[model samples]
Target chain A: MPMPQVPFDDRGLAYGDGVFETVLLRAGVPVLWDYHYARLLLGCQRLNIPLPSREQLVATWQSPPNAELEILKLILTRGSGGRGYATPDNSQPRLLSRRTPFVVNADRWHEGVNIRICQLRLGHQPLLAGIKHLNRLENVLARQEWNDPAIAEGLLGDADGWLVEATSMNVFWQQAGALFTPPLSQCGVAGTLRAALLDHGVVQEAAIALTAIHQVDRLWVANSVQGVWPVNKLLSETGVVLQSWNPAGHDRLQVVGHELLGYSPTSR
Target chain B: MPMPQVPFDDRGLAYGDGVFETVLLRAGVPVLWDYHYARLLLGCQRLNIPLPSREQLVATWQSPPNAELEILKLILTRGSGGRGYATPDNSQPRLLSRRTPFVVNADRWHEGVNIRICQLRLGHQPLLAGIKHLNRLENVLARQEWNDPAIAEGLLGDADGWLVEATSMNVFWQQAGALFTPPLSQCGVAGTLRAALLDHGVVQEAAIALTAIHQVDRLWVANSVQGVWPVNKLLSETGVVLQSWNPAGHDRLQVVGHELLGYSPTSR
Candidate 1:
């Protein structure tokens, strides 16, 4: 299929003036549709962009190519506006969706993935924190920190050295059988899967420091697209192993992922 | 003219992964073309997007639009990419430009305009600071703080309460016959006009606090679109007058504007 073309005046392109969702499609069905949609609405409200009807989104997701496993990206922009930053009273919201083939490797999922810490520190802005807004240059720079395919992701922290999240996933650590994740009120995105884990009472949000990652018994990173992946090794920028863990807790997370995201380890 | 359409996969919409410039066109010619193009190139370099050739940009800006006074917005995005924050190896850059009619009121230029302080504070991101990139949600939110036409602009400060810039213009204050503007190294855009003023040795960049704004003898806001507007009164969020200045320095700034921006109050 051909890619969609966006207007030059799109406020999204002009000012990163929009929000987005990346949903995993399994067997032609979108997973965690409710959570994604709810987050989208919240983002719209935060930016004061008019919300599109729910039916419009559902219809777009329902009528799609029958791909077995794909990544469905939905971008909601404040349409087009004038040259300045002021929101026009007559401005309308726009929805753009596209699908791309994707496959999660079973080996990486089973034997956890390696991660490295990023040098780029995210600045604190509560007004823009926790929402999947389009102003993501920080994430882009963090993700570009490593070129080695062995490093699955890069961990990011706030300017004050508080552990936030991975480049695109939420970070969670298990210490004494209690799952703890960082509070994203100051920085970092609030992932849909992270919220689901919290709602299911499997994870607790707390203020975590970068140094605390070494004391954790187990670590995992998660997103809606890949569900969850255990962290086998965490490395610093100098390539020194900060921490390493066994995959003993992988099975428990697999069960939790199945219950929360309707994901199956064997599906891949 | 109608608005331009953008593609769904455009990186500018995806992650504000682009650079932009707003140039003022007088009698169908782009004002301060050299400075705007230089800044655009610098922004593209900072974001790692391939720079568009100068010939391509000049040709676009030089095209006759037949407008008396207009605002020409030029956006250059990293074309399309896969669904991720990482830049694609084979990504192509896209250029989009549109012209819209705009005119500065004579009263605003001659009698000075009222200004207000915004509640939304700008975050410090030295990596993305000073460059007029596509991530402008902060400015968008700040501009929406007040709809009162009497308030010509909103003054924004960094998270540390240091004055940065207005919602769209660079801020300058004259104290004891010396022009002082906020340093944009930590936050705020380094506007083209601001650079021009500095190059002329008429303005000095300093770390000025929000409270220091009241002590200044005179104030002015500047951008390429609108040459310069003197601030007659500065108001707090509760409509209380924070600082009021006479028009003593307005004529001096007008001469500076005429020399630097080729702007004449009588031309409009």
Candidate 2:
């Protein structure tokens, strides 16, 4: 497939004026298409962007695929516009879908990945919260906090010290046999898989704090492409080992994760 | 000049993982080129993007212009990269420069432009507060609040009710005899003209609340391209007029605005 090239004046580039979704593609079929599409539409409505028809999006995905296991990134931007931040009424919405080969460390699934608390705190913006918008510098900066291969993820908290999410994934923990994830009412991208878990009646959304990390029985981070990664050790910015957990319940969670994400960790 | 075409995978579109500078071009020369370049460089440094050399950027600007009075938009994105929020170490920064004809109403200067307080509050993110990075959904949303030609700009405040800036410009108000502009330490774009005003000691950076708007003797919205626009009347979201100014001190501020912005409202 040829790589797509957008006009330089695209509002997506100009102001990050768009929303996006990344779905796992298996055998050229996008996994959890309905959920991704629903969220994409919701985001468009929230931003007042004209929603692209579902048929238009489906037609875009029918193109030939280069990889069996791939990640399909769908970006819906407010197309091109003139100078200034105001949305042009005549501007059409653009659907840009790109396929990239999916790859993840199988070893990390067996041996839980280490995680760290990022120094950068997420800003509270209820309007933009929970929406997978293109304005993701916060996640990018949080991810850049460390370059260690062992540290698979960085946990991000909002300004008020409430844990929000990992840099690119939604975080959940099992405390005394009950599942809990941070409330994303103020900030963080509410991952599709995280919603699936909640819908499946396994995870409950609550206000989890940084201090609560020490009390968790088990911890895991989940995203669409990466599936779920259990956290073996959580570290503070000053290199303090805050919490360490054994991967006792990881296999059981992976089984549920496979059902929700439509991908098995062992296949990776 | 031709419109720039960036690769679809450009991080600017994918994550708004970039920074931009819109410089006013007069007779094919970019106005306040030094300040724009400096801000762009600072933004790049803050975002950890590789800084494009001054010569390279200058060479890009040497392209023959098609418009006499134009707005030159220069976007620097962490070029094309694979999936996820992580910045690719091998990613080369891409520079996109496009020229658009500049046009503004001269009547807006004479009969001061009406402004309104935006319903959308700027989120407080100290990491991204001042630097004009590409993650500007807040500004876009704020700008979309009104389409009335009578209302030239929307004043945005932070989540804490402290006034921040207008949708696309820095705001200044005179209380008694002192000029006060909201501090950008918590939110809002620390605009080029705003910095110049602070550097020239014409505007002092302080916390200005929305309640204090009624007490202001004079109000102005400023940017590099449009210079300064005096506010004749400020309105609430419900269309109720909050503060009406006499525009008595507009000329004085315009003189200082011209000195700092390198352009005059009358000239435009």
Q: List candidate 2 segments past 4 Å from native.
A: A249-252, A264-268, B64-68, B262-268
Looking at model 1 chain A, which ten-residue stretch has the lowest summed lDDT?
A259-268
Model 1 alpha-carbon drift over 4 Å, by segment? A249-251, A265-268, B1-3, B248-250, B265-268
- Give residue B200's error in model 1 in angstroms: 1.1
lDDT of 2 at B182: 87
In candidate 1 the C-alpha lDDT for residue B232 amounts to 92
Q: Over the stretch A24-124, how does candidate 2's per-residue lDDT look in tens digits?
A: 88878888787788788779988999988878888766877678788888889999988889889889988888777776655777777899999999998
Model 2's chain B yields a TM-score of 0.94
* Model 2 steric clash pairs: none
| Interface RMSD, every prediction, one decimal place | 1.4, 0.8
Per-candidate Cα RMSD to the true structure, in Å, reads 2.1, 2.1
